[model samples]
Target chain A: MNRYLRQLKEGILDQNPTLVQLLGMCPTLATTTSLENAFGMGMAATAVLICSNVFISLLRKFIPRQVRIAAYIVIVSGFVTAVELLMRAYLYPLYQALGLFIPLIVVNCIILARAEAFASKNKVLPSAMDGLSMGLGFTFALCILGTVRELLGSGSLLGYRVLPESYPDMVVFLLPPGAFLTLGFVIAAVQKLRGMSEERRRRRSAAPADTAAGATAPVAADGAHSAGEADGAGRKED
Target chain B: MNPNQPQPASMPELLTVSPSPHARRGVTTSRLMIDVLIALAPAAVWGVAAFGPRAALVLLLSVASALLAEFLAEKLLRRPVTLRDGSAAVTGLLLGMNLSADVPLYIPVVGAVFAIAVVKQLFGGIGRNVMNPALAARVFLMLAWTGGMTRFSAPFAYLSSGVDAVASATPLASLKGGMLPDASLADLFLGRCAGCIGEVSVLLLLAGGVYLLVRRVISWQIPVSFLGTVALLTFVFPQGGADRLSFMAASLCSGGLVLGAVFMATDYVTSPVTGAGRLIYGCGCGLLVVFIRYFGGYPEGVSFAILIMNALVWYLDMLTRPRVYGKTRGRRGDRKGGGQA
Candidate 1:
């Protein structure tokens, strides 16, 4: 149970495939122009991820070590094709909107990376959870970017007129440059919050021993992270 | 960082002392900024005088918003506030100058905020940004609000606000359609033209440029090469006219060419440091202006040209890198053996 919870934490924030590990940037940048498109891309990529993770985990023993990468791609592409056809048959407009991207999910780094790193060595349940968590993280990132771009670019939200009529539209946000700009800022904010939390965690863990040495002001920042971890362990004894 | 050092015996003895050059110089970042502000005063005065209080209001709003944004950003980023350096003020003033006087009051405020917060501060604050903040903000305003950004009013519109304040075509617009504007050479030179607030007066802008030169605030390479190239190109190919000289003069005097070349292109942080690189960057700006003016949809290309050249500044520096004296490690076996042979 603890292992499953740890995997969830890792996938969501600590080792997020989109924000931290920086995988699957193609779909993240291309389909995130609107909330609807981003949601569709996210669900499609999640479907592929979950199916690939389960199948790869089940066939782990049969797959030869030497041919693992090729085997993984074949398995991922099979699932991607399934999702693509299902979308084309049922959700035609979304399929047309995300036409090339659905098939291209086969090459998404997150799915292949998880398969190689976690699913091949783990059981089916935990592997599925990993896929779910990573998919959720990617979806959250895409939605944040999409909401910002849509609101600023067209003064609307999810195809609804939220802003007043006089609100001047910033047309640049609809262009390619706006995508990069919005993504860059949102990612920067995420990283900043992460850094602050890590700093707070370090300070809290180092509290008991801090009285003996009046202040352990970091003389150099190079080894500060590791030193903070060491201090956390030291406080465990007290 | 050295906390174990001996404490000062008295409260007044805590100051650290260093050796040599004890006399403090009068120059500082703030002083240089004040000099630039002083140099820009004449052209700004003329712009306000010619375009009326709307131009003045734009300038004031731009400077105020820029200062406010700078203060907030520095505080948020946990960096020391340096708004007293007046870089933000300069950026806002230049941005206002680039705008058409007829734009809504909120345009300058938005441009100023973007200039200070995004272009200047987000890229690591003053002296660290890759492009001129004011020019980048102007380009953003131009791209996002095309109608408001390009609506030029006739000269002395402030005097007769009802009639002349209506939208009028700029000289650069007529030049785009292959003819000169109705304004004559003397009117263009003396600021009786339809254009951006501060860019109409070629005479006063040149005077400001000369003031900066006299004060040693800027070197001459960028302005000289930039203007010289535009002059050469237009003189060689007179569009729709047998008189090449008049066309060349009109090209030089019209639109934002003089304003951009003198003030925006020579921004210290955005332009290259070396002499050779500065010349090449200037020539590149001039060529791009000519190219865009001739072929692009817009009549004026000063902002775009400067921005496009701004991106190449790092490469320009690398290509024009001055060889250091003691860097003799790379002339290896092939060159020495081939020379001997």
Candidate 2:
């Protein structure tokens, strides 16, 4: 249970598939042109990821080391095929909306990377948790980007009117050039925020060392009585 | 002291030195661009005379708006003001020439803003843009304001003279819509038509083209290959033999082809620098123009064709790289050397 919890936490935050790992970019950019399409594609990809991860973990021992990559691909393609059929049958509209992208998920680096890096070595429960968490993380990131693009491009959110009628939509935001510019800026912003937090941590660690040195220097320069008094207060605080 | 001798009492002097080609040709960017502008004058004058003073007004508005947009974008982006590069002015003039005389004033302004700010400077300015800035902006504006762009009527006075000047579509538009009346080759050559400014008069536009060619400001290959390819394709697969001459004339004379072949398609940034690459690029553009005009929804394909070809220039250049001196054409298993096997 503890191992599964650790695995889930690592996948969700520490090594997010979309943000940190930077995998599965084609679908991320294409499906993200509309909010509805983004949500549909994200859920579809997540379903494939979880199923493939669990199956790969359970069958890890039987797969030979030399042809492990090919074996993993076959398993992934099986799950993806199932997902594709289900979507076509039950969710035909979304299936059409996603178009050629559902088949492309079979090649998404995230699923293969997880199978090789984690699931093949880990037990089934932990592997399933890893898959679920990472899939959710990817879905979350895609939603954020989609919301921004759809809102700015068409002045709507999830097909809902968010901005007033007076606001002019920049039609370029929906074009190919806009996709590149938006993705580049969003990645840069995330990197900048990470850098800022790291700086904050360094400053917090250095502040107490300076204060402690100042207290020690004055105590040492004074007589034994002052030194004893300073030591006593410091020990009490500690 | 001998007059021929140098002054001996002077301390060692610092002399500024420059690289060996110190013999300089007196050509500034401003002056070169100004000369190109002068070269473009005959076409502009012909357009105005044929279309009237409204063409002149569009030219003025487009030039001013392009310069102003360049100035404002530079200020906003904190880049050094480069309005003096003469590139912006050229862009303005070409854009003006492409537009009909009576297009709404705001349309040119919007087109100019897109040209200078988005297409030019955003891609790193002057020589760095991937597509011709003027054409890119024009296409963007055309897509955005399709009603204004395609609603080109003849000059008001030309219409008022009982000249049977209906809201006639351009020859390309007529050809695409399958409504071409029996237009004559002679009429097409003479500038008695309704079309974009600077595009109605093939002879006058050719005069400007000849001047540019004589000046060696642009090479002959791109223009020749581009126009030649279109001519060949039209002759080979024309719609009808009865109107063959008119079809050929219309193909050359209609919207933005002369302007694009002579100027816009030859843009320094978007066009390939090597000779062979440029020829290939031109031919590709010509083929696309014909393909789109014949089958696609758009009436004019010059802007889109040029833009698409611009995207392929890098690949074309790679494929047509100049062979290095002393390199063998083909040698097997020469992996140790720089040559490919």
Candidate 3:
């Protein structure tokens, strides 16, 4: 259970394939023009991630090392096709909005990176958990980007006008440059927050060691002083 | 102990040490920035005079947003705040001049912030930015708010309307339909017709450019080559056959050509540093302007032209590299004595 939890944390925060490792950016940049599109894309990619990971893990022992990559792509594509079809039937508008990105998900790097890095080497249960956590992380990042883009680009959230009527929409936010600008700032902000927390942790770990060194210095000084005093006494007796 | 005493001669009060070249000149970044601002002031004044108080408002908002963005970005990025250098002020002023006076208040603010924050500071600030900040912001605004940006008004139309205004086409729009605008050449030259706040007065902008030239604030390469290329192109192919001289004159004065060539294109950070490279960059800008004016969707192509050239500045510099010293003694394959880099 502990190992599973660690793997979950590692996938979501430590090794987030979207934010940290920065894989599968084509959909992350292209499909994140609005929240609905982003949510749909994220969920679809996550589904594929989970299924492919589980399938690859189950077949790891039987799969040959040399031809494993070709086999893994075959499995990943199958899952991607299934997600694409399901969305096409029920969520047609989002599927249309996402357009070429849905079909292109078969080539998304995150699924392949995971299949190679984790599932091929790990057990079925841990591989599935890894897939779940990574999918959640990607969804989280995409949702954030999408929300910002939709809110600023159209001054609405989930097709609802949350901002006042007077708010002027910056159409750039819905465009390609806006994607890069939002992603860059988002990454910079996350790095800054992470840096601050890591600094606090370092200082907390170092504080006691510093005080212990402070306590030892005086004792060492006292021992030197006593040794000098004994030498002085010996000199006086002589 | 020696509170009233000065440092002894053996111990200097200040010590200075740095690498070679040892020559000193009074020219600093701040001084150059101030000079550029001084050169820009006449054009800004003309914009306000022509477009009324609304133009002044846009200019103020642009300058303020730029300064605010610079101060905030510096603080956030934890770099030493160099707002005192007046670079942000220049950028803001340029952006304001490029805008239609009738745009909503938010346009200048957004454009200014985008200019300073994204184009200038985000790309490592100051000399490191790849594109001209003011021009990039203009393009960004143009793309995002095409309707708002292009809703230019007739000259002094705002004097009657107060706030709510109607759309009136300028000379560039008339040229789009392959006809010269109804305004006389003198009106265009004096800038008594409708246009962007800063770009209407070819006379004042040229005067400012001359002042910059006289003060040595910028070199002659970019302005000369850029304007010359544009003039040559339009003269060779007169649009609408409204007499060759008038068409050439109209083409030169109608758009942001003078303002962009003199001010924005000559931005020291984004323009090429080499003498030959500056010429090439300028010519490229001019060609793009003429092409866009002739065939592209928009009437004004100055901002887009300069931006496209700005991207290729590094390659321009590479193509125009000066021969390194002592390289004439060319050695071969480490077989000869002289070291080859």
- Would you give me the overall lDDT of model 2? 0.77
**Tens-place lDDT digits, model 3, residues B1-341:** 22334556687658688898699778888998888888878877888887889899999999999999999988876678989988999899999999999988899999999899888877767887888898899999987888789877777766775655656789888877778888888999888878899999888888889988998889999999999999999888888767778888888888788999999899988899899999999999999999999999888888989989988998998778666654443235323535543
Candidate 2, CAPRI quality class derived from DockQ: incorrect
1 versus 2: better DockQ goes to: 1
Residue range B161-230, candidate 2, lDDT tens digits: 7553346666776667654533455566666667778777777777777887787778898999999998
Candidate 3 chain A minimal-lDDT segment of 10 residues: A229-238
Taking the tens digit of each residue's C-alpha lDDT, what string does model 2 give over A98-119?
9999999999999999999988
Cα error, candidate 1, residue A174 (Å): 1.8
TM-score of each: 0.86, 0.74, 0.87
Q: Give the worst 10-residue stretch by lDDT in candidate 1 chain A.
A: A229-238
Q: Evaluate model 1 with DockQ and give the value.
A: 0.26
Ranked candidates (DockQ, high to low): 1, 3, 2
How accurate locally is residue B259 in candidate 3, as Cα lDDT from 0 to 100?
Answer: 90
TM-score of 3: 0.87
Of the candidates numbered 2 and 3, which has the greater lDDT value?
3
Q: Looking at model 1 chain B, which ten-residue stretch has the lowest summed lDDT?
A: B325-334
What TM-score number comes out for model 1? 0.86
Clashing pairs in 1: none
| Per-residue alpha-carbon lDDT of candidate 3 for residues A1-238, written as tens digits (9 for 90 to 100) | 8988887787777777787788998999899988998988889989999999999999999999999989998999999889989989999998899989887888899999999999999999989998998998899899999999999889999999988998878788899988877887777656555555555565566556768575555444445544443333222201
